[model samples]
Target: MAENYYQTLGVDRHASAEEIKKSYRKLARKYHPDVSKEADAEEKMQAINVAYDTLNNPEKKAEYDQMLDNPQGFAGFGQGAQGQGGFDGAHFYRQSTGGGEHADFSGFEDLFGRFGAGFGGSGSRRQQQSFQGEDQHAKIEVDLDVAYTGTTQQITLQIPTYNAHGEPEIQRKTLQVKIPKGMKEGQQIRLSGQGQAGINGGKAGDLYIEIQYKEDKRLYVEGADVYTTIDVSPWEAALGGQVEVNTPAGRLQINLPANAKNGQQLRLKGKGIPNSKEAGNLYLIINIVLPTAQNDQQKQAYQQLAQAFNAYNPRA
Candidate 1:
Protein backbone atom coordinates (compact mmCIF):
# COMPACT_ATOMS: atom_id res chain seq x y z
CA MET A 1 0.00 0.00 0.00
CA ALA A 2 1.12 3.56 -0.75
CA GLU A 3 1.77 6.04 2.06
CA ASN A 4 -0.99 8.52 2.93
CA TYR A 5 -0.33 11.89 1.20
CA TYR A 6 -1.57 13.90 4.17
CA GLN A 7 0.70 11.95 6.57
CA THR A 8 3.68 12.41 4.23
CA LEU A 9 3.17 16.19 4.25
CA GLY A 10 2.51 16.24 8.03
CA VAL A 11 -0.82 17.99 7.53
CA ASP A 12 -4.33 17.17 8.68
CA ARG A 13 -6.77 15.77 6.10
CA HIS A 14 -8.82 18.98 6.19
CA ALA A 15 -5.86 21.32 5.95
CA SER A 16 -6.43 24.31 3.68
CA ALA A 17 -4.62 24.72 0.38
CA GLU A 18 -2.63 27.67 1.70
CA GLU A 19 -1.58 25.69 4.79
CA ILE A 20 -0.44 22.80 2.62
CA LYS A 21 1.55 25.09 0.37
CA LYS A 22 3.26 26.74 3.36
CA SER A 23 4.25 23.37 4.78
CA TYR A 24 5.56 22.24 1.39
CA ARG A 25 7.72 25.33 0.89
CA LYS A 26 9.20 25.05 4.37
CA LEU A 27 9.97 21.35 3.88
CA ALA A 28 11.36 21.91 0.39
CA ARG A 29 13.81 24.53 1.62
CA LYS A 30 14.98 22.21 4.35
CA TYR A 31 15.33 19.13 2.14
CA HIS A 32 16.55 20.73 -1.10
CA PRO A 33 19.46 18.61 -2.35
CA ASP A 34 21.63 21.64 -3.08
CA VAL A 35 21.76 22.73 0.55
CA SER A 36 20.75 19.74 2.65
CA LYS A 37 23.58 17.35 3.67
CA GLU A 38 21.32 14.47 4.63
CA ALA A 39 21.97 11.27 2.70
CA ASP A 40 18.29 10.91 1.82
CA ALA A 41 17.64 14.59 1.04
CA GLU A 42 16.74 13.87 -2.58
CA GLU A 43 14.31 11.15 -1.65
CA LYS A 44 12.62 13.33 1.00
CA MET A 45 12.41 16.24 -1.43
CA GLN A 46 10.81 14.00 -4.10
CA ALA A 47 8.18 12.83 -1.63
CA ILE A 48 7.46 16.39 -0.49
CA ASN A 49 7.14 17.58 -4.09
CA VAL A 50 4.79 14.73 -4.99
CA ALA A 51 2.59 15.32 -1.95
CA TYR A 52 2.41 19.11 -2.58
CA ASP A 53 1.58 18.61 -6.27
CA THR A 54 -1.25 16.26 -5.43
CA LEU A 55 -2.85 18.23 -2.57
CA ASN A 56 -2.39 21.68 -4.14
CA ASN A 57 -4.69 20.81 -7.04
CA PRO A 58 -8.40 20.89 -6.18
CA GLU A 59 -9.49 18.05 -8.47
CA LYS A 60 -6.62 15.75 -7.45
CA LYS A 61 -7.25 16.45 -3.78
CA ALA A 62 -10.93 15.59 -4.15
CA GLU A 63 -10.09 12.31 -5.82
CA TYR A 64 -7.48 11.56 -3.18
CA ASP A 65 -10.00 12.22 -0.41
CA GLN A 66 -12.45 9.87 -2.05
CA MET A 67 -9.85 7.09 -2.25
CA LEU A 68 -8.99 7.62 1.39
CA ASP A 69 -12.67 7.44 2.39
CA ASN A 70 -13.21 4.18 0.45
CA PRO A 71 -9.87 2.39 -0.03
CA GLN A 72 -11.68 -0.66 -1.47
CA GLY A 73 -12.93 1.42 -4.41
CA PHE A 74 -9.40 2.09 -5.78
CA ALA A 75 -7.74 -1.28 -4.95
CA GLY A 76 -7.53 -2.29 -8.56
CA PHE A 77 -7.06 1.18 -10.15
CA GLY A 78 -3.55 0.41 -11.37
CA GLN A 79 -4.13 -3.38 -11.67
CA GLY A 80 -5.83 -5.17 -14.55
CA ALA A 81 -9.63 -5.67 -14.58
CA GLN A 82 -9.27 -9.47 -14.07
CA GLY A 83 -8.11 -9.07 -10.45
CA GLN A 84 -10.63 -10.50 -8.00
CA GLY A 85 -11.11 -7.36 -5.97
CA GLY A 86 -13.96 -6.73 -3.46
CA PHE A 87 -15.11 -3.68 -5.51
CA ASP A 88 -17.31 -4.42 -8.56
CA GLY A 89 -14.97 -4.14 -11.55
CA ALA A 90 -17.78 -3.21 -13.95
CA HIS A 91 -18.88 -0.18 -11.90
CA PHE A 92 -15.27 0.97 -11.32
CA TYR A 93 -14.45 0.55 -14.99
CA ARG A 94 -17.47 2.59 -16.02
CA GLN A 95 -16.60 5.44 -13.60
CA SER A 96 -12.95 5.47 -14.72
CA THR A 97 -13.59 5.33 -18.51
CA GLY A 98 -17.11 6.58 -19.18
CA GLY A 99 -16.77 10.12 -17.81
CA GLY A 100 -16.37 13.03 -20.23
CA GLU A 101 -14.17 14.82 -17.68
CA HIS A 102 -10.51 14.22 -18.62
CA ALA A 103 -7.93 13.51 -15.90
CA ASP A 104 -5.48 16.37 -15.47
CA PHE A 105 -1.90 15.07 -15.96
CA SER A 106 -0.13 18.46 -15.88
CA GLY A 107 1.26 17.99 -12.34
CA PHE A 108 2.68 14.58 -13.21
CA GLU A 109 4.71 16.01 -16.08
CA ASP A 110 6.12 18.78 -13.88
CA LEU A 111 6.94 16.35 -11.07
CA PHE A 112 8.85 14.03 -13.36
CA GLY A 113 10.68 16.92 -15.08
CA ARG A 114 11.77 18.51 -11.79
CA PHE A 115 12.79 15.39 -9.83
CA GLY A 116 13.99 13.21 -12.69
CA ALA A 117 17.14 15.32 -13.02
CA GLY A 118 18.16 14.09 -9.54
CA PHE A 119 18.11 10.53 -10.83
CA GLY A 120 20.75 11.03 -13.58
CA GLY A 121 18.56 12.79 -16.14
CA SER A 122 20.13 16.26 -15.83
CA GLY A 123 21.54 16.22 -19.39
CA SER A 124 18.06 16.26 -20.97
CA ARG A 125 16.48 18.91 -18.72
CA ARG A 126 15.91 22.52 -19.75
CA GLN A 127 16.89 25.52 -17.65
CA GLN A 128 14.34 27.28 -15.44
CA GLN A 129 13.01 30.51 -16.98
CA SER A 130 13.01 32.80 -13.95
CA PHE A 131 13.62 32.61 -10.24
CA GLN A 132 13.68 35.27 -7.54
CA GLY A 133 16.93 35.68 -5.60
CA GLU A 134 17.15 34.89 -1.90
CA ASP A 135 16.90 37.77 0.54
CA GLN A 136 20.01 38.80 2.55
CA HIS A 137 20.21 40.11 6.13
CA ALA A 138 23.02 41.91 7.95
CA LYS A 139 23.64 43.91 11.11
CA ILE A 140 25.09 47.46 11.18
CA GLU A 141 26.67 48.93 14.31
CA VAL A 142 26.24 52.68 14.83
CA ASP A 143 27.43 54.87 17.65
CA LEU A 144 24.89 56.78 19.74
CA ASP A 145 26.25 60.06 18.39
CA VAL A 146 25.71 58.88 14.84
CA ALA A 147 22.18 57.78 15.71
CA TYR A 148 21.47 61.14 17.37
CA THR A 149 22.81 63.09 14.38
CA GLY A 150 22.18 61.49 11.02
CA THR A 151 25.37 60.70 9.15
CA THR A 152 26.54 58.87 6.10
CA GLN A 153 28.66 55.73 6.58
CA GLN A 154 30.70 53.81 4.04
CA ILE A 155 30.04 50.09 4.50
CA THR A 156 31.75 47.16 2.83
CA LEU A 157 29.78 43.99 2.16
CA GLN A 158 30.62 40.56 0.79
CA ILE A 159 27.99 40.30 -1.90
CA PRO A 160 27.35 37.25 -4.04
CA THR A 161 28.02 37.97 -7.70
CA TYR A 162 27.68 35.84 -10.80
CA ASN A 163 30.59 35.44 -13.16
CA ALA A 164 30.61 35.06 -16.94
CA HIS A 165 30.16 31.29 -16.62
CA GLY A 166 27.15 31.78 -14.34
CA GLU A 167 29.07 30.64 -11.28
CA PRO A 168 28.52 32.34 -7.89
CA GLU A 169 31.43 34.20 -6.24
CA ILE A 170 31.75 36.50 -3.28
CA GLN A 171 32.73 40.04 -4.24
CA ARG A 172 33.44 42.92 -1.92
CA LYS A 173 31.06 45.84 -2.48
CA THR A 174 31.24 49.30 -0.92
CA LEU A 175 28.14 51.42 -0.35
CA GLN A 176 27.63 54.81 1.26
CA VAL A 177 24.43 54.48 3.31
CA LYS A 178 22.67 57.32 5.03
CA ILE A 179 21.87 56.60 8.66
CA PRO A 180 18.70 58.46 9.45
CA LYS A 181 18.36 60.34 12.70
CA GLY A 182 16.14 58.89 15.47
CA MET A 183 16.48 55.39 13.99
CA LYS A 184 16.00 53.08 16.97
CA GLU A 185 17.98 49.94 17.71
CA GLY A 186 16.60 46.73 16.19
CA GLN A 187 14.97 48.78 13.39
CA GLN A 188 15.59 47.55 9.85
CA ILE A 189 16.79 49.67 6.96
CA ARG A 190 15.98 48.07 3.65
CA LEU A 191 18.10 48.61 0.56
CA SER A 192 16.26 47.51 -2.53
CA GLY A 193 18.02 45.51 -5.22
CA GLN A 194 21.18 45.17 -3.12
CA GLY A 195 20.89 41.49 -2.20
CA GLN A 196 21.56 38.31 -4.23
CA ALA A 197 21.37 38.54 -8.00
CA GLY A 198 18.29 37.12 -9.70
CA ILE A 199 18.32 34.22 -12.14
CA ASN A 200 17.04 34.25 -15.72
CA GLY A 201 15.95 37.93 -15.78
CA GLY A 202 14.13 37.80 -12.46
CA LYS A 203 14.24 40.80 -10.11
CA ALA A 204 16.85 40.84 -7.36
CA GLY A 205 15.95 40.48 -3.69
CA ASP A 206 16.29 43.18 -0.97
CA LEU A 207 18.97 43.66 1.70
CA TYR A 208 17.77 44.28 5.25
CA ILE A 209 20.19 46.12 7.58
CA GLU A 210 19.46 45.88 11.28
CA ILE A 211 20.72 48.77 13.44
CA GLN A 212 22.61 48.05 16.66
CA TYR A 213 23.91 50.71 19.04
CA LYS A 214 27.49 50.50 20.24
CA GLU A 215 27.75 50.06 23.98
CA ASP A 216 28.34 53.38 25.75
CA LYS A 217 29.34 53.39 29.40
CA ARG A 218 27.60 56.69 30.08
CA LEU A 219 24.51 56.44 27.98
CA TYR A 220 21.73 53.84 27.63
CA VAL A 221 18.83 53.97 25.22
CA GLU A 222 15.24 52.73 25.51
CA GLY A 223 13.18 53.46 22.45
CA ALA A 224 13.68 57.17 21.77
CA ASP A 225 14.55 58.09 25.35
CA VAL A 226 18.18 58.42 26.51
CA TYR A 227 19.45 57.87 30.02
CA THR A 228 22.79 58.75 31.67
CA THR A 229 24.13 58.73 35.19
CA ILE A 230 25.81 61.98 36.32
CA ASP A 231 28.16 61.96 39.31
CA VAL A 232 27.94 64.93 41.72
CA SER A 233 29.93 65.77 44.79
CA PRO A 234 28.11 65.38 48.13
CA TRP A 235 28.33 69.11 48.76
CA GLU A 236 26.97 69.84 45.30
CA ALA A 237 23.93 67.64 45.98
CA ALA A 238 23.43 69.35 49.39
CA LEU A 239 24.00 72.97 48.31
CA GLY A 240 21.80 73.01 45.15
CA GLY A 241 23.76 74.74 42.39
CA GLN A 242 24.09 74.87 38.65
CA VAL A 243 26.43 72.32 37.13
CA GLU A 244 27.67 72.08 33.55
CA VAL A 245 27.21 68.67 31.96
CA ASN A 246 27.71 67.09 28.58
CA THR A 247 24.57 65.64 26.97
CA PRO A 248 23.98 63.91 23.66
CA ALA A 249 22.33 67.04 22.27
CA GLY A 250 25.14 69.33 23.52
CA ARG A 251 26.55 70.93 26.62
CA LEU A 252 23.92 72.16 29.10
CA GLN A 253 23.64 73.46 32.65
CA ILE A 254 21.35 71.71 35.08
CA ASN A 255 20.20 72.95 38.50
CA LEU A 256 20.42 70.42 41.34
CA PRO A 257 17.75 70.65 44.01
CA ALA A 258 18.80 71.26 47.63
CA ASN A 259 19.24 68.11 49.70
CA ALA A 260 18.80 66.03 46.54
CA LYS A 261 19.11 62.35 47.36
CA ASN A 262 21.22 59.90 45.42
CA GLY A 263 19.59 58.02 42.53
CA GLN A 264 17.27 60.96 41.78
CA GLN A 265 16.31 61.30 38.14
CA LEU A 266 15.87 64.69 36.48
CA ARG A 267 14.00 64.89 33.21
CA LEU A 268 15.26 67.12 30.42
CA LYS A 269 12.31 67.40 28.08
CA GLY A 270 12.84 67.29 24.32
CA LYS A 271 16.57 66.72 24.67
CA GLY A 272 16.64 63.12 23.37
CA ILE A 273 16.27 61.75 19.83
CA PRO A 274 14.30 64.14 17.65
CA ASN A 275 11.59 62.50 15.57
CA SER A 276 8.79 64.15 13.66
CA LYS A 277 6.29 61.67 15.02
CA GLU A 278 7.32 61.69 18.67
CA ALA A 279 10.40 63.15 20.39
CA GLY A 280 12.07 61.41 23.37
CA ASN A 281 13.14 62.88 26.72
CA LEU A 282 16.57 62.75 28.36
CA TYR A 283 16.88 61.60 31.98
CA LEU A 284 19.79 62.50 34.26
CA ILE A 285 20.26 60.04 37.08
CA ILE A 286 22.10 61.68 40.00
CA ASN A 287 24.79 59.80 41.95
CA ILE A 288 26.42 61.50 44.94
CA VAL A 289 30.19 60.91 45.38
CA LEU A 290 31.62 61.21 48.87
CA PRO A 291 35.07 62.72 49.36
CA THR A 292 37.82 60.53 50.84
CA ALA A 293 39.71 62.10 53.81
CA GLN A 294 43.29 61.09 52.94
CA ASN A 295 45.09 63.96 54.70
CA ASP A 296 45.14 64.65 58.47
CA GLN A 297 43.42 68.06 58.01
CA GLN A 298 40.71 66.51 55.83
CA LYS A 299 40.22 63.72 58.40
CA GLN A 300 39.85 66.32 61.17
CA ALA A 301 37.33 68.28 59.08
CA TYR A 302 35.31 65.10 58.44
CA GLN A 303 35.44 64.27 62.19
CA GLN A 304 34.01 67.70 63.00
CA LEU A 305 31.26 67.31 60.37
CA ALA A 306 30.41 63.83 61.70
CA GLN A 307 30.03 65.27 65.18
CA ALA A 308 27.80 68.07 63.79
CA PHE A 309 25.44 65.62 62.07
CA ASN A 310 25.58 62.97 64.79
CA ALA A 311 21.93 63.60 65.67
CA TYR A 312 20.89 63.19 62.01
CA ASN A 313 21.07 59.44 61.61
CA PRO A 314 20.47 58.16 58.08
CA ARG A 315 18.96 54.90 59.38
CA ALA A 316 16.42 56.89 61.45
Candidate 2:
Protein backbone atom coordinates (compact mmCIF):
# COMPACT_ATOMS: atom_id res chain seq x y z
CA MET A 1 0.00 0.00 0.00
CA ALA A 2 1.14 3.53 -0.74
CA GLU A 3 2.02 5.42 2.40
CA ASN A 4 0.24 8.64 3.26
CA TYR A 5 2.48 11.53 2.24
CA TYR A 6 1.26 13.93 4.89
CA GLN A 7 1.88 11.31 7.57
CA THR A 8 5.33 10.58 6.17
CA LEU A 9 6.17 14.29 6.32
CA GLY A 10 4.41 14.56 9.68
CA VAL A 11 2.17 17.38 8.54
CA ASP A 12 -1.56 17.98 8.56
CA ARG A 13 -3.83 17.24 5.63
CA HIS A 14 -4.53 20.97 5.05
CA ALA A 15 -0.86 21.93 5.09
CA SER A 16 0.01 24.92 2.93
CA ALA A 17 2.55 24.88 0.10
CA GLU A 18 5.30 26.27 2.25
CA GLU A 19 4.49 23.74 4.97
CA ILE A 20 4.62 20.94 2.40
CA LYS A 21 8.00 22.05 1.10
CA LYS A 22 9.39 22.44 4.58
CA SER A 23 8.19 19.03 5.67
CA TYR A 24 9.62 17.40 2.55
CA ARG A 25 13.04 18.97 3.05
CA LYS A 26 13.17 17.85 6.66
CA LEU A 27 12.22 14.28 5.79
CA ALA A 28 14.39 14.15 2.65
CA ARG A 29 17.50 14.99 4.58
CA LYS A 30 16.59 12.49 7.26
CA TYR A 31 16.23 9.57 4.83
CA HIS A 32 18.55 10.55 2.00
CA PRO A 33 20.27 7.40 0.72
CA ASP A 34 23.82 8.66 1.22
CA VAL A 35 23.44 9.54 4.88
CA SER A 36 20.74 7.43 6.53
CA LYS A 37 21.19 4.13 8.37
CA GLU A 38 17.54 3.53 9.22
CA ALA A 39 16.04 0.41 7.71
CA ASP A 40 14.22 1.20 4.42
CA ALA A 41 15.46 4.77 4.46
CA GLU A 42 15.49 5.03 0.65
CA GLU A 43 11.96 3.72 0.43
CA LYS A 44 10.90 6.39 2.91
CA MET A 45 12.68 9.08 0.88
CA GLN A 46 11.00 7.96 -2.35
CA ALA A 47 7.60 8.14 -0.68
CA ILE A 48 8.33 11.61 0.60
CA ASN A 49 9.37 12.77 -2.86
CA VAL A 50 6.25 11.31 -4.41
CA ALA A 51 4.06 13.07 -1.88
CA TYR A 52 5.89 16.35 -2.37
CA ASP A 53 5.68 16.02 -6.16
CA THR A 54 1.94 15.48 -5.98
CA LEU A 55 1.09 18.08 -3.35
CA ASN A 56 3.54 20.86 -4.21
CA ASN A 57 2.00 21.43 -7.63
CA PRO A 58 -1.51 22.93 -7.63
CA GLU A 59 -2.63 21.16 -10.83
CA LYS A 60 -1.50 17.74 -9.66
CA LYS A 61 -3.08 18.28 -6.28
CA ALA A 62 -6.37 19.24 -7.88
CA GLU A 63 -6.33 16.18 -10.12
CA TYR A 64 -5.48 13.93 -7.22
CA ASP A 65 -8.29 15.42 -5.14
CA GLN A 66 -10.72 14.95 -7.99
CA MET A 67 -9.87 11.27 -8.24
CA LEU A 68 -10.26 10.89 -4.52
CA ASP A 69 -13.66 12.59 -4.39
CA ASN A 70 -15.17 10.70 -7.28
CA PRO A 71 -13.28 7.47 -7.71
CA GLN A 72 -15.42 6.01 -10.55
CA GLY A 73 -16.89 9.15 -12.07
CA PHE A 74 -14.13 10.53 -14.26
CA ALA A 75 -12.81 8.18 -16.93
CA GLY A 76 -10.13 10.51 -18.33
CA PHE A 77 -11.23 13.98 -17.34
CA GLY A 78 -8.33 14.60 -15.05
CA GLN A 79 -10.27 17.69 -14.13
CA GLY A 80 -13.41 16.35 -12.43
CA ALA A 81 -16.95 17.75 -12.45
CA GLN A 82 -17.12 18.49 -8.74
CA GLY A 83 -16.34 22.27 -8.94
CA GLN A 84 -17.66 22.48 -12.50
CA GLY A 85 -21.34 21.88 -11.64
CA GLY A 86 -22.63 22.63 -15.19
CA PHE A 87 -20.20 20.13 -16.70
CA ASP A 88 -22.00 16.91 -17.73
CA GLY A 89 -21.85 14.06 -20.24
CA ALA A 90 -23.03 16.34 -23.11
CA HIS A 91 -20.28 18.91 -22.47
CA PHE A 92 -17.68 16.15 -22.31
CA TYR A 93 -18.97 14.55 -25.55
CA ARG A 94 -19.07 17.92 -27.32
CA GLN A 95 -15.53 18.67 -26.25
CA SER A 96 -14.43 15.18 -27.31
CA THR A 97 -16.31 15.04 -30.66
CA GLY A 98 -15.27 18.46 -31.94
CA GLY A 99 -18.83 19.82 -31.62
CA GLY A 100 -19.98 23.48 -31.57
CA GLU A 101 -18.72 24.31 -28.05
CA HIS A 102 -15.14 23.51 -29.10
CA ALA A 103 -15.60 23.89 -32.93
CA ASP A 104 -13.14 26.80 -32.92
CA PHE A 105 -10.63 24.72 -30.91
CA SER A 106 -7.73 22.91 -32.58
CA GLY A 107 -7.15 19.13 -32.36
CA PHE A 108 -5.41 17.49 -29.42
CA GLU A 109 -2.06 17.33 -31.23
CA ASP A 110 -1.91 21.09 -31.95
CA LEU A 111 -3.37 21.95 -28.53
CA PHE A 112 -0.87 19.65 -26.79
CA GLY A 113 2.00 20.97 -28.92
CA ARG A 114 1.19 24.55 -27.94
CA PHE A 115 0.79 23.55 -24.30
CA GLY A 116 4.07 21.63 -24.45
CA ALA A 117 5.82 24.66 -25.86
CA GLY A 118 4.23 27.18 -23.50
CA PHE A 119 3.59 25.66 -20.06
CA GLY A 120 6.22 22.92 -20.10
CA GLY A 121 8.93 25.24 -21.44
CA SER A 122 8.03 28.01 -19.00
CA GLY A 123 7.93 25.55 -16.07
CA SER A 124 11.37 24.21 -17.01
CA ARG A 125 12.68 27.77 -17.34
CA ARG A 126 11.26 28.74 -13.99
CA GLN A 127 12.82 25.68 -12.37
CA GLN A 128 16.13 26.54 -14.01
CA GLN A 129 15.84 30.07 -12.66
CA SER A 130 14.82 28.93 -9.21
CA PHE A 131 16.68 30.92 -6.55
CA GLN A 132 17.68 28.07 -4.26
CA GLY A 133 20.50 28.74 -1.81
CA GLU A 134 23.40 26.32 -1.61
CA ASP A 135 22.88 23.22 0.51
CA GLN A 136 25.02 23.05 3.65
CA HIS A 137 26.64 19.88 5.02
CA ALA A 138 28.32 19.23 8.35
CA LYS A 139 29.28 16.35 10.65
CA ILE A 140 28.42 16.08 14.34
CA GLU A 141 30.05 13.78 16.85
CA VAL A 142 27.63 12.43 19.43
CA ASP A 143 28.53 9.96 22.12
CA LEU A 144 27.44 6.34 21.68
CA ASP A 145 25.72 6.64 25.04
CA VAL A 146 23.71 9.50 23.61
CA ALA A 147 22.90 7.44 20.54
CA TYR A 148 21.61 4.71 22.82
CA THR A 149 19.42 7.11 24.75
CA GLY A 150 18.63 9.94 22.30
CA THR A 151 19.84 13.43 23.00
CA THR A 152 19.46 17.04 21.91
CA GLN A 153 22.53 18.85 20.70
CA GLN A 154 23.34 22.47 20.08
CA ILE A 155 25.26 22.54 16.83
CA THR A 156 26.90 25.39 14.96
CA LEU A 157 27.13 25.16 11.20
CA GLN A 158 29.35 27.29 9.01
CA ILE A 159 28.01 27.40 5.46
CA PRO A 160 29.23 29.32 2.48
CA THR A 161 26.63 31.80 1.29
CA TYR A 162 26.43 32.16 -2.48
CA ASN A 163 25.63 35.05 -4.80
CA ALA A 164 23.30 34.98 -7.79
CA HIS A 165 26.09 33.49 -9.88
CA GLY A 166 26.90 31.03 -7.07
CA GLU A 167 30.05 32.77 -5.76
CA PRO A 168 30.91 31.78 -2.19
CA GLU A 169 30.53 34.18 0.73
CA ILE A 170 30.73 33.72 4.50
CA GLN A 171 27.98 32.84 7.00
CA ARG A 172 27.63 31.14 10.36
CA LYS A 173 24.50 29.76 11.97
CA THR A 174 23.67 27.82 15.13
CA LEU A 175 20.77 25.45 15.65
CA GLN A 176 19.40 23.47 18.56
CA VAL A 177 18.43 20.10 17.11
CA LYS A 178 16.46 17.43 18.88
CA ILE A 179 18.23 14.23 17.99
CA PRO A 180 15.53 11.61 17.59
CA LYS A 181 15.70 8.62 19.89
CA GLY A 182 17.34 5.58 18.31
CA MET A 183 19.38 7.67 15.89
CA LYS A 184 22.45 5.78 14.71
CA GLU A 185 25.78 6.61 13.10
CA GLY A 186 25.62 8.12 9.61
CA GLN A 187 22.05 9.24 10.31
CA GLN A 188 21.24 12.88 9.52
CA ILE A 189 19.39 15.65 11.24
CA ARG A 190 18.25 18.35 8.85
CA LEU A 191 17.62 21.89 9.92
CA SER A 192 15.56 23.85 7.42
CA GLY A 193 16.25 27.55 6.78
CA GLN A 194 19.52 27.10 8.66
CA GLY A 195 21.75 26.94 5.61
CA GLN A 196 22.93 29.85 3.42
CA ALA A 197 20.49 32.65 2.86
CA GLY A 198 18.23 32.15 -0.12
CA ILE A 199 18.95 33.78 -3.46
CA ASN A 200 16.38 36.53 -3.95
CA GLY A 201 13.46 35.72 -1.58
CA GLY A 202 13.37 31.97 -1.97
CA LYS A 203 13.45 29.71 1.10
CA ALA A 204 16.86 28.68 2.36
CA GLY A 205 18.02 25.22 1.28
CA ASP A 206 18.98 23.26 4.44
CA LEU A 207 21.75 22.22 6.84
CA TYR A 208 22.45 18.46 6.90
CA ILE A 209 24.34 17.09 9.90
CA GLU A 210 25.84 13.64 9.57
CA ILE A 211 26.06 11.79 12.87
CA GLN A 212 29.33 10.39 14.21
CA TYR A 213 29.63 8.42 17.42
CA LYS A 214 32.27 8.98 20.09
CA GLU A 215 34.23 5.89 21.05
CA ASP A 216 33.53 4.33 24.43
CA LYS A 217 36.42 2.44 25.95
CA ARG A 218 34.41 0.65 28.61
CA LEU A 219 31.37 -0.38 26.62
CA TYR A 220 30.95 -1.41 23.00
CA VAL A 221 27.43 -0.92 21.69
CA GLU A 222 25.88 -2.94 18.89
CA GLY A 223 22.34 -1.85 18.26
CA ALA A 224 20.63 -2.08 21.62
CA ASP A 225 23.00 -4.22 23.72
CA VAL A 226 26.39 -3.35 25.19
CA TYR A 227 29.55 -5.45 25.70
CA THR A 228 32.47 -4.93 28.07
CA THR A 229 35.25 -6.82 29.79
CA ILE A 230 35.44 -6.97 33.56
CA ASP A 231 38.65 -7.93 35.31
CA VAL A 232 38.73 -10.28 38.30
CA SER A 233 41.46 -11.61 40.57
CA PRO A 234 42.51 -15.30 40.37
CA TRP A 235 40.79 -16.02 43.64
CA GLU A 236 37.61 -14.28 42.52
CA ALA A 237 37.53 -16.61 39.52
CA ALA A 238 37.95 -19.57 41.87
CA LEU A 239 35.26 -18.32 44.32
CA GLY A 240 32.55 -16.16 42.76
CA GLY A 241 31.04 -13.19 44.67
CA GLN A 242 29.37 -9.83 44.17
CA VAL A 243 31.56 -7.15 42.58
CA GLU A 244 31.22 -3.45 41.93
CA VAL A 245 30.92 -2.58 38.24
CA ASN A 246 30.43 0.52 36.11
CA THR A 247 27.83 0.69 33.35
CA PRO A 248 26.65 3.46 31.04
CA ALA A 249 23.81 4.25 33.39
CA GLY A 250 25.92 4.20 36.55
CA ARG A 251 27.91 2.01 38.85
CA LEU A 252 26.20 -1.04 40.24
CA GLN A 253 27.15 -4.18 42.15
CA ILE A 254 26.55 -7.39 40.25
CA ASN A 255 27.17 -11.04 40.98
CA LEU A 256 30.39 -12.57 39.66
CA PRO A 257 30.35 -16.33 40.08
CA ALA A 258 33.26 -17.87 41.97
CA ASN A 259 33.76 -20.37 39.12
CA ALA A 260 33.74 -17.60 36.45
CA LYS A 261 36.27 -18.47 33.76
CA ASN A 262 38.20 -16.11 31.48
CA GLY A 263 36.23 -15.10 28.37
CA GLN A 264 32.98 -16.33 29.94
CA GLN A 265 30.00 -14.08 29.38
CA LEU A 266 27.76 -12.76 32.16
CA ARG A 267 24.57 -10.96 31.15
CA LEU A 268 22.87 -8.17 33.03
CA LYS A 269 19.29 -7.67 31.89
CA GLY A 270 17.80 -4.27 31.07
CA LYS A 271 21.00 -2.43 31.74
CA GLY A 272 21.96 -1.04 28.35
CA ILE A 273 20.58 1.81 26.20
CA PRO A 274 17.02 2.90 26.85
CA ASN A 275 15.81 3.58 23.33
CA SER A 276 15.08 -0.05 22.65
CA LYS A 277 11.46 -1.08 23.32
CA GLU A 278 12.84 -3.61 25.71
CA ALA A 279 15.78 -2.36 27.76
CA GLY A 280 19.05 -3.49 26.26
CA ASN A 281 21.20 -6.03 28.05
CA LEU A 282 24.78 -5.56 29.28
CA TYR A 283 27.26 -8.38 28.64
CA LEU A 284 30.34 -8.70 30.79
CA ILE A 285 33.14 -11.04 29.79
CA ILE A 286 35.56 -12.14 32.45
CA ASN A 287 39.24 -11.20 32.23
CA ILE A 288 41.53 -12.72 34.82
CA VAL A 289 44.96 -11.20 35.52
CA LEU A 290 47.60 -12.71 37.85
CA PRO A 291 49.16 -10.60 40.57
CA THR A 292 52.96 -10.21 40.07
CA ALA A 293 55.40 -10.64 42.94
CA GLN A 294 56.51 -7.17 44.09
CA ASN A 295 58.41 -7.79 47.34
CA ASP A 296 60.11 -10.61 49.25
CA GLN A 297 57.13 -10.88 51.63
CA GLN A 298 54.61 -11.09 48.71
CA LYS A 299 56.76 -13.69 46.92
CA GLN A 300 57.04 -15.70 50.16
CA ALA A 301 53.28 -15.53 50.73
CA TYR A 302 52.58 -16.76 47.18
CA GLN A 303 55.14 -19.54 47.62
CA GLN A 304 53.52 -20.62 50.90
CA LEU A 305 50.04 -20.56 49.35
CA ALA A 306 51.25 -22.55 46.32
CA GLN A 307 52.85 -25.06 48.68
CA ALA A 308 49.59 -25.43 50.60
CA PHE A 309 47.54 -25.76 47.41
CA ASN A 310 50.18 -27.73 45.44
CA ALA A 311 48.65 -26.15 42.32
CA TYR A 312 51.80 -25.03 40.45
CA ASN A 313 52.50 -26.63 37.06
CA PRO A 314 54.73 -24.41 34.88
CA ARG A 315 53.67 -25.94 31.53
CA ALA A 316 50.09 -26.48 32.61
- Each model's TM-score, in the order given? 0.66, 0.53
Query: Backbone collision count in every prediction?
Result: 0, 3
Please report the candidate that would top lDDT against the real structure: 1
Over 1-316, each residue of candidate 1 has an lDDT whose tens digit, in order, gives 4456787788999899878975775465556665556788777877777677668877667766786788687776554322344333233324433353453334445565765555334566543334345568888898877767989899998876553234558868788888899888899889998877665565777888889999988789999999988899988999988998888877889998999999999999988888888789999999899989999999999899899888988887
Per-residue lDDT of model 2, residues 1-316, tens digit only:
3334466678887889988886675565456544456787646655565556557767656655655567566555443232343223223333544457554323323333422332223453222112355568889888766755677788776676654433456767777888876665677888887776654366787888888777767557776677887888988888888888766656779888877888999988877666546767889978898899999998998889889779768588
Off by over 4 Å in 1: 1-73, 79-128, 156-174
Each model's lDDT comes to: 0.73, 0.64
